[model samples]
Target: MPGGGAGARRRGRPRKDEPALTERVVLDAGVRLLARDGLDAVTMRGLAAELGVRAASLYRYVRNKDELLDALADEQFAGIDLTRYVQDDWRAALTAMATALRRHLLARRDAARLIAGRFTTGPHSLRNIEALLTVLRGAGLSDHDAAFAAYTCVTSLFGFVAAEQNRLSAEVAAGMAPREYLDRLAGRLRAMPADRYPNVVALAGELTAPDLAARFDFAMARLLAGIDALVAAGEPR
Candidate 1:
């Protein structure tokens, strides 16, 4: 009789011995799905299946797909290390922070797209912004200028990563190596009439270089230089 009761219990609805699903668990599953299959595949139904739960169960943790994505972005932001970038020299600190952000974004597929247009007030995101503001203010920027600096840095990061990802995807789709693609582009640029586009023709090699790192570094330097000039002029603060 005791054996029969144990068997009945097993045959009956399985006990929920596993821990209850939390927002973290749902977001983790969503991130894995996003990384493996891209953003289109990271749906509530898909995530539920990944977690061996029903789609409706996900609603208990997140209201909808948008919220789920926000949770995912928050998780990604939580991983960024701003400690090394929070130093006396704001220029160095900002550079480090931007570099770190770009590196982290590129680590996951479609990650740049995920966080690009969305505004997140999550703790981690807020913390990162606070760190940036602190660094800029320390460098003699007023509150308004510091906020603007932080915004500029983040917008540049998102745009750069988004463009980089798109270019990589295009290269893969076209089945062309990065250098080969750039060479082809250079050739096209050189074909333009030298009289009409002399500068473009002359700078084709530099313009079409495949060195993304150099391009990013140059852009960052220019941005910081503009800020330094403004600071020197005692414009805002």
Candidate 2:
């Protein structure tokens, strides 16, 4: 019994070698739970359990579920590549930012779901926002238009990514291939009588095309074109 201390081991207590729980550790566990299970599975109690800690301990780092979600949303912004944001070309800068944001959101499960509901002001989020505003201002946008463009870009990203995720999830749950699912959708649209739904019948294939990248680029091109027109018009501040 020289090295053994069997009697000293207590139930439900951390081992002497256990790492201390910090906010970052808690957030990491929360993200893992979200990715492995989904958004609804990331409650305080569940996260505590995932970390093998008491539920009350999590409160020391994150007071509640809302704070956790906000922190997580901010954390997702950490992965964006700000270096690629071109300063001289506002359109290029914005397009790069938007594309990077979309990629980051879609990389994690339910990332957009939580981010859409939370307004994060963490350092990473603020840095990205600052970059966006700078580009807008450099493009000769008024303060109001800069604000509007920033909000519009972020909201559009959230909406489009959320829709893409939902569609992918639905396809997975239905046990169908992506192309098969789109084909089925196209068929359903084409089935409607041409007399009643001429446009829909005529463009069913185009409507249900699975080219999300092309569609997203087209949408952003149109939005940026409108903003470009506003800049050209020299709208009053």
Candidate 3:
């Protein structure tokens, strides 16, 4: 029984009690969707539905899904406590940062894949890069070397996390626990012909150990050793 013009106007207007939508709100909704349904579920339309708003409304905040993902990556970087590295030795600082990044990405589903290889110029990401550069420069690396080192460290961290996630997914799809799978894999390695693969057969247990933490630590130590050697060799700026 409502009049067409007046009713349409009333419906179009936001109520005083309604909360105003902001960029943060849109990003937050996107985060929740990413967490619950993985990165593939995050889209302008999906986020709008979650927020109970029109998809066009989200464009005011983020131009597209790629921008929204950059924001989410920025959000992840913001959680890292860079202050804790203020007094840390250069190696310790890098290790802490890498460890924190890996843990953060692993905590969210598809988080590593979401942020990996995406160049984000957002505030949080810039801050993290600056911190890394500072750490490398503090360790006596020249300006150019520090920049390259920082880039290497960040890319390595992202790459490692992406690979780790893939391994986890494969394990899940195979319907076998990680340890069980590793044990079976080790057994197969041990069965290989000694003449053709002596070293692999001889170290099957070490190669297929289920201790991801230990393996990660070992690899990180090796990477740091190489960096330290480069710093010692004083590679030209």
Candidate 4:
């Protein structure tokens, strides 16, 4: 009877040799699921299975899926190397940061979508914001301008990356090469009534520019130029 009860206990409970289920372990597993599969694959049960634990166990760390997603977004931010974006020139530093962030978001499946609309309070997220603010302030921006610039840059990054990912996925889903899709789109734009839409008919190709990276660079350059003008104007007296 004693041996039978011990065997039953062992069957129902986790083995002593199994790894402990900590927040970091759960978050790491979630990252793996998100990267390997996608945002949809990061359910509590799925993550628990990935970590060899029960679904209920994950609640010890995260309250729900939304909390898990917020944590995962923070994890992605944590993975970014802020030092890599550091530069003596503010424009160069911000450019590097934006470029690095785009690449980072694209590296994982649905990473950009996962981060969109979530305001994480994790240390990594805070550090990233602090770093951006520091860069803007160092560039001689007024406090108001610095805050505005930081918000603008972050929102632009997320929106741009999300759109980029969605476009790529759409192309893949439609079974068309990206260039082919762009060409088709350009054709449609060019066929518009010239009198009604002169610019759309005239510059369809440019409108559907194939080089998103170059476009992103152009955008950042324009943003920096505007900031530079503000700096030249000197804080509003």
Candidate 5:
């Protein structure tokens, strides 16, 4: 009767206050270590210590460090709404995807760096790509052009987010203020002899001008817009 359906007993529910066990804990601990100290600190042992469990216990949930890292990478994409996102107007859809990606990466600034360059073919990433492909096709792009456009936009988003995250570090934040840094650079350029460098000295402010956020937005948006236009006007078959 112990293992039989006739008189088998169901497993008891855990007490309300009882701590449940799962890969969630493992992954959450990995994320915390990753966010606090970057990817290098996220060994299985380190994650176990962070979770207050034996290092060997992690094997029950994750097979190895690679699996944990994959889980951590997948966590970043957990915030995206693929169904809603892939359903919008092509340009609007692309913008939404980029914005969502930026927000997700910005939240766990360290996590962004870890997962950016790894072979990113997880379900979420593929779904996003498939959506991008579909949108490009809808906008009258050839297969090659669609793929290239998707690569451009996705990579640009990742690069922008990574650069922003790097600069947003506490050290950079506490060090030279961006505006002051730009002002100092402006001064340096102004000090240059106009006779030697007329063009640079004449446009000192233009050279050192720092409209970082707006400038970044303008650049990313323009790049995507350009790709959209080009893909929409794909070469003849």
Candidate 6:
């Protein structure tokens, strides 16, 4: 438990000449690189530079770009404690897992895109997916539905975070507020005739709250609710 999470890998500072071979060290270093630079910036050469190891040594932990992406995904998802959900009531458990997964993915900013679908092939990723599937299967989902539900939940999270990241800008990062940004946007929307775009005019205020977390939660809840309804209707998992 001590050597876990982001700080876990760095429980003690690395000695000047020592580099850690532990998977946690390797994954954390990679994540730090991706967070600082975008996904494209995380080449073997770049990762080696961060870990202070020869590029080839990375193979012990990850094989290629695909493997590297998997590792990244595993690191992000490592926070999930599946055992808690395993004992929860079926539908409630799945929804809870969805919310937790979305929050974890969104917290990492652009990191979600790096891991969404690569889990099946990566060791750590496969383990994470298996954990989720195990929980779902116990709750009464067929393997097929469990897999599909997993896909839907993951994609929903990725899309939500990606959209939120796109809307962020350097100026906004510094001091520009969303309210100021939306005020200007509202002015532009006002210039259009209400009669021409009745729904847009009436719901002008609704579009302004681009609350990434709230919107993601609302959408995820609805999607899971639909999934539950479908299941009850005898729809395939």
Global Cα RMSD, each model:
8.6, 8.0, 7.5, 7.5, 8.0, 6.8
Candidate 2 lDDT: 0.79
Tell me the lDDT of model 1 at 161: 89
Question: How high is the CA lDDT of each candidate model?
Answer: 0.78, 0.79, 0.75, 0.79, 0.69, 0.67
lDDT for 188 (candidate 1): 88
- Number of clashing pairs, model 5? 0
What stretches of model 5 exceed 4 Å from their correct place? 1-21, 168-178, 185-210
lDDT of 5: 0.69
Compared with the true structure, what per-residue lDDT tens digits does model 4 show for residues 28-121? Answer: 8888999888888889788878988776655656666777888888888877866566666998899888888889888877888898877778
lDDT of 2 by residue, 1-237 (tens): 011133322223444544578657887898789889988898988987898877766555666677777877777777885655857988888888888888888888888887885667788877878888888889999898889887888888898898888755477577888788889889989999999999999999999898999999998998899889879987866
Candidate 3 lDDT tens digits, 1-237: 011133222323323444567657777888899888877889888987888877765555666666778888777776776656644488898888788878978877777788778778777777877777778888888788777777788777777777777655466567878778878888989999999999999999998766777877887898798789878988776
lDDT of 1: 0.78
Where does candidate 3 clash, by residue pair? none
* Candidate 1 error regions (>4 Å): 1-20, 168-171, 193-200
Candidate 2 local lDDT, residue 222 = 88
**Candidate 3 displacement at residue 4 in angstroms:** 38
User: Candidate 6 at 103: error in angstroms?
Assistant: 2.8
Look at candidate 1 and give me any clashing residue pairs.
none
TM-score of 5: 0.71
Which tens-of-lDDT digit does each residue in 80-197 have in candidate 6?
Answer: 6654665546667666766776666667757667765554444445565676777666656677887887777667766777666654556566778867877766676766788898
* Cα distance off (Å), candidate 3, residue 41: 1.4
- After best superposition, candidate 5 residue 125: deviation in angstroms? 3.0
Over 1-237, each residue of candidate 5 has an lDDT whose tens digit, in order, gives 001132121222324443454656667777789888877798978986787666665565666677677777767776675556765477777777667777778888565676766555567656666776877677777777777777777777777777766754354468977667668777988899989999999899986666656766786679777877776567844
